[model samples]
Target: LEEETEIASWTENGGLFVGTNAERLAEYKRFAETGKYFGIESHVLSPSEVKEVHPLLRIDDIYGGVYSPGDGTIDPTSVCNAYAKASRKFGGGVYENVGVSGIEVEDYLTAGSAPGRRIKAVLTSCGKRIETPTVVNACGAWANEIAAMVGAQIPLKAMKHAMVLTEPIAGMHSGLPNVRDHDLSVYLKTQGDSMAIGGYEQNPEFWPDVDPGFAFGLFELDYDTFGQNLAGHMQRCPVIEETGIKSTVCGPESFTPDHKPLMGPHPGLRGLFHACGFNSMGLMLGGGVGRELTKWILTGSPEVDLFSFDCARFHPESVASSRWVRDRTHESYAKTYAIVFPHDEALAGRGSRKSALYDELKSRGSKEPLDYDLYGACAESGLAFWLVDQGAYEEGAWRLGEADHPDIPKHQSHEYLDLVEGELTFDWPASHATVAEECRAAREGVAIFDQSYFGKFYLSGPEADEAVQYLCGADIEGKRAGSVTYTPLCNSRGGVEADLTVTKLQDSAGSNYYYFAAGGNTATKDLAWIRKVLEDQNFKAQIEDQSEAMTLISVQGPSSRRLLQSLTHSDMSDESLPFSGAKHLEIAGHPLLVLRLTFVGELGFELHTPAESAVEVYRAVQEAGAKLSQLEGIPVRDAGYRAIDSLSAEKNLRHWHADLSNRDTPLEAGIGFTVLSKLKRTGS
Candidate 1:
């Protein structure tokens, strides 16, 4: 969606094309030419002004070309070399010029009475043993075989692909762009002094014959015969005929049933990771996939957007036992590069193309979406889109296959998804673009989701700040009356059980403190746990539950100040008053607990107004915030579970259940300081 850049300008760096058209199939009779037509400007050369750029072409004989300023030709060998050098730059262990013989899988992941029953170590052909907690099969092309050794079947196959380079002609300049006749399914790009034009193989079908085992390897090529195929190609770039002869490279291009990459752990095989099946396009997606791979191994989070290419989706068991492996592989050859069919129709008890955009996505690049609602369901919705388009949600996880999974609730206490209402009660991923809309509405004017359940606590006494500092992780010592601090409270055992904001309040009555926590366990457990801890210390603060009288409506986003300013006489800007500050103010002619703070990381306010006036303040924020329509504040970002995973990983924050292994410690997880230093010592 080019929110900030052009999508058409992305690099089409590779030179391999699989499959071909019907007409070209007849001409390349001796050789099996496969793949669809994809002609573009070579490397960096543009395709749009071809005839004008290269006067040697007869416009009629030349097919339309690419004038892409974004496209550039790259030397494949150089890319691999750079990658190898970079890998060594870090402490990564790399082995070269070595061959793997086979692997040994212990039948099960369970340990026996003795010990180490899951996996001992792998014996190499050279009689060396490599023992580790996990093994990543990044061995390209050979991934499927390695997976099979561990009893995990992968849909990986290898198909032969070839590239032809023409001899340099005298008039040929080195600046020609890569050109492809989309109709003919052939592409031509220049490399150094020579022109590297391939995809002349008219067919992309893997099997030369109906059988997969018919033949697999780079067959010999005739230069003169190859030149004949470019008869009309030279008409587009007249300088091409001036070039002499050159060599060609044809080798096996690893492929999968669907041309997409295979990522994530081997489903049935625990502790095994697969990062293979790139086909020819692997290099294009390497960086993102490499990062995701490291994350998955350390955290057990599925590789981002990984479900679509999960190795478990396809079952070799589906193939008839009588079916030859080669035959099965050949039938799926076209599917590798063909538009991908969403990996559905295989989930338990669900196998129908019933979705509206099902067939459409099968033929186009779908839009990815990331969605979340305030209560907590963070879901990324997958929408089927044929071509790229511009929008806030475009090109996000919203349309990825993995984005559809229901965000499994964190707390079993309350059912997240209500089958009765179809309303999710958790912060979900697929609901983000929508929730962000709701958030924007509230920030600008006002809106409310059911904060009917936010956990609330009222603590009051002359020793209020002291009591708060003792029981929670906040330095209430510095917060003057009417100030608030958003703090994350750690459980006595040192886990983040609550994310609450503390507000010091005052009136003619006296100064008191209010602590509102995130919903679900984030609220209820927070107050109950803190109260238990404080009461144990015999603290003098009076703690009471105020959940019944208060309704928490977080009015956040840019229009927050304007919305509140309209209802109350309070000046809300940093210059006028300040922020992370609050006061009881009149809103729509009613007393309200309007705390000028936010959670969506914006210049918004959290109105802890009375429940009776909840809808009023909500309406007020909506009305007043509507008038100040400038996007002055940072947009609230809720990127769902995957995003949270990344953030938590960076913060060295461990989820109580997910990241907490049997022996993991605060020090090992890097949160020891947040615990012993902050909580155990100077804390209650």
Candidate 2:
């Protein structure tokens, strides 16, 4: 683990983020709110001050800069050497020229009869057999191979990254702050008497495999391939073109699918942990990562929510495909310096994990063309889910609409509506069916909507009920089977981690299960959290992520019951299937699990149908509702989420991550009804 850069320097003086365009610079200033919220001292720097900080810059080309005085650079070699010396002084063993060959494990059942894997011993290359109860896979580039030894898959790949050191140039200040121009995709810092330059090129070269012999060795430098970054460096600092190249340093660095590092316990294997895949950010994040990981290792959970860096954030599908991992890793590396706006989907390594209806929906042209550049600024202010400025008419901008009383704009937001002839149409089929018209249809007439993107999951096994009760804020155990309990999955601090709906599907002797549903964006966050809890607590339960396995269609409005009664033989009365009640029945021979719950504050039923029969059931409901609406002389229309949001807002309902986030408690968010104090879920 002894590795280092040649230079030995440490400074807390932050650097400058220079940009040429004023709009881009303003976008960066808005993005810096994240740092400001964290209590970091950051400010927008003027062109003149930028020269005062780093005088070598070409000031005319730069428009503005963001300077953070608390952030700075350090030499990793010095830190590692200091740690190594201190560890050896404390009688810690240091093995050189040796590596772990394989890991041995013993499988056993817990007291709850849940299976567990414990590390038994480790075999090293130096012919050493050591007994150990734990293993930390800190192998940087070879982390995946080490994880494979224990049958654990780590979605990490090695990407070949290169850097160039300049031959000590005149007027080079040894203490000059590091400069990062993300637009140019380049970074520059002082290395001894010379300047070090590196960047993330769009077409980064990644190693297909990580050979043991490749460790601590540089790859053959490809100047032609390096020219892209070289050009960027020249653009950032014209002086770099005058200084002669001293040497090129090219080596393999571990990268994860996301730019964030992997830092938690291995999802599949017990007694094994991963702290690699720094994505070339190891040196900067090492100290903080070490402190947090140490707390996690000792207490079974870290104080902070590391969902972004969790190793299990990725699934087996991602790990099974090396090519996909390579491509995603390359994207992560390349975008290391690129602006990642809200709702910006990665263009690489998609479709590896998709729903059964992915092709059907895609072929039907259900995609919404998102303009990230236009929406990114608003998104930075925690309003990503809200419609951007252009969507003011689609989802009425109440602040502006109420204040100015401007003329109503055309409704152009149809992101969540039913596909018309298998295509998403922003405009209504009929001029009378506007957004306001749809809102009225939902309040008076019956409306059917698509809820296919709901994050669905099923928890099954003997301990299912107890496991959920332990994790939820509401009293789920007291709820009867076939009843839905809306609750929040709280962190240890009793902050809302996720707001979800859970139904006790079965509670009979020797059989127990629960069905859970959350927002689509929380598929990974919620699942990874429950799995981590199950693993740590040795819960005898299995979690099934049915997010894409089932398609959800919702029916709401005053006449929804009558419309559904005409199609299904099941009881539709409030006395039989009351609110929060669930029933398993059939519609048009398609099996369905119906939950009588409403997000739009109305009499609604969410029908969960098998993905294969979703289309059939949807068509049956549509046709039946249409007939009922025509006979009743009321409009029967399909509505989108925008209508639902307006309705929910009118009813004072809370939206997770918007009004209710991990930072707030249920009571604080004015949703104390969703929580039961009997559960004793308050954070002390």
List the candidates' TM-scores in order.
0.40, 0.79
> How many pairs of residues in model 1 come into backbone collision?
72
lDDT of 1 by residue, 1-684 (tens): 122222232334333221134322232221222222344333222223455554444445432332444456555555666666666667566675454555666753111111112334566657677876577777665565566566566656655555667776554455655555544434566665566665433224342222322233365564443444466456445666666558767665566644567776554344677788776667666767788888766754433335445454343332112122333343343222222221111111111111122223223332322122111121222222112222212212121212223353333432112210122222233334544455444444433333334556777656666767765555566557877766545544434444467777765786666555444323433454455445545565656667656765555546456556767776666865567777676878778666765444456666676767665665565455445544544332212233333433554555533454213344444545434545444554
lDDT of 2 by residue, 1-684 (tens): 232333344667577789887655866787678887888888788888988888877777889898887778777767777666756766877777887888999997653455667788999998899998778888988888888888878788877888898998677766777888888888887775678888887667767767887767888778876888889888777888888998889988888877888887775566787899998888888878888888768766666656567675565556677766766666667778765543343434434444343344334443311212110101111111222223332222221123223554435434322122112122232222344666787899876666666668888766777788887888776677889989888776677878899988764464768898876545555776676676656777868788667877788888888888988899989998999999999998998899999888888999988988987787788789769867878677666555676788988888875687665778888878777564455542
Model 1: CA > 4 A from native: 1-48, 53-66, 109-120, 200-244, 302-304, 315-684
**What lDDT does the true structure give each of the candidates?**
0.47, 0.71
RMSD of each: 17.7, 9.4
For model 2, the superposed segments whose C-alpha errors exceed 4 Å read 1-9, 86-93, 110-118, 359-457, 460-467, 489-499, 507-512, 518-548, 554-566, 598-603, 624-673, 679-684
The 10 consecutive residues of candidate 1 with the worst lDDT sum are 344-353
